[model samples]
Target: MTSEADLAWIASVVGDPARLRILLSLMDGRARTAKELAFLARIAAPTASGHLAKLLDSRLVAVEPQGRHRYFRIASPLVAQMVETMSAVAGDASPGDRRLRRIDPALAAARTCYDHLAGRLGVAIADALQARGHVAFGDGSGEVTASGRAFFAALGLDLAEAGHGRRVFCKPCLDWTERRHHIAGGLGAAFCGHCLSAGWIRRHRDSRAVEVSPEGRVALAELLGVDGQALTSGWPERAAA
Candidate 1:
């Protein structure tokens, strides 16, 4: 059971601007070195180190030693979900808000929410799946239907293997940018991996943004009836409804 004290403690750890920045920097599901995290967080190395130490102690982040350097990443999908939910609450900017304009177009279109996809494209895909009766969302969780399993199987994704981990197999993750739910959890991760391996999506070199390849447009249309072009170009107007 969680106590009020525990909640307050976590809030303090995550409330610091610098630590929040560091946490957001690792939301791409990539392990980053302290130096890299410092640069990304726009803080001095020492400051970043202190923040990282706090996060480590809080178990919000984990570190792995790779050769001579240590790389840090968000500890788990649950932590990532918490951060994203908080971000959504904090970033309730109106559509006309200047802060919204400052957002990277590509990032707003398609990006990774931890290991799974998020943003307009992600939401669109989820919508498509739900529309096609491939997946169903209910009370923040999701269920992959019989046809859904067959659909993924046809794409060479084995749902049994994807669900082997302790993580939930399918769930709805609220999208901070899209103000909608995109699929998350183990199934979501497996699908994201399949997209990458199939060359349907390419991650940006410096950011969490993902670009849908030309082949991706055709493939998604054929496979899931998703409009990759419109999603990647800008926000879908219907999504605002």
Candidate 2:
């Protein structure tokens, strides 16, 4: 059980602008060295190192030594979710707010929320799954139906293997940009992995935005009935719910 003191400690650890920048830089599920993180966070090497020590102490980030370099990454998926959720809360601008209109188009279209998908593309996939009775979301968790198992099996994804870990099997992650839920957890990781491996989606260099390939368009259209072109071209605006 996390006491109020524990919660406040964590909030303070993550509240620093430089530390939050470092955390966001690692949100793409990549481990980065201190030098690289300093560059990304736009802080001096010594300053970034100090911030990193605090993050390490808070257990919000982890370090792995590779060769002579120490790489830092968000400690776990739970940590990533917390950061994303906080972003959503902090980014709740009014509809007519200029900040809302200034969001990057590519990121708002499709991006990685840690290892899984987020943005319009992610939400579309979730909607398709629910509409087809492949998955169901209730409260904060989700479940795959029997047919959903078969559907994933057809795609060569082993749910048992994906779920065989300490991580949550499936859950809804609130997208900061979309202000809607996108699939997260083990199932979300597996699906995103399959897409990347199958050449359906390609991650941008040093960025979370992903581009759908020609093959991805066909695959998503046939499999999930998602219009990749519409997603890419910015059609299908967010309608009234």
lDDT tens string, model 1, 1-241? 4788888889999999899889888776667899999999999999999999999988888776657788788775458768767766778733333444467878888999999999878887887888889999875479999999999999999888889968899998867665557999989999999999999999999999998898987897778765657656544445533
Report clash pairs, candidate 2. none
Q: How would you encode candidate 2's per-residue C-alpha lDDT over 38-123 as one tens digit per residue?
A: 99999999999999999999888877665788878777545866876677788863332344456788888788999999987887
User: Each model's C-alpha lDDT?
Assistant: 0.82, 0.81
TM-score of 2: 0.57
Please tell me which predicted candidate would have the highest lDDT against the true structure.
1
What is the alpha-carbon lDDT for the whole of candidate 1? 0.82
Name the weakest run of 10 consecutive residues (lDDT summed) in model 2: 232-241
Once fitted onto the true fold, the runs of candidate 2 whose alpha carbons sit more than 4 angstroms away are: 1-96, 232-241
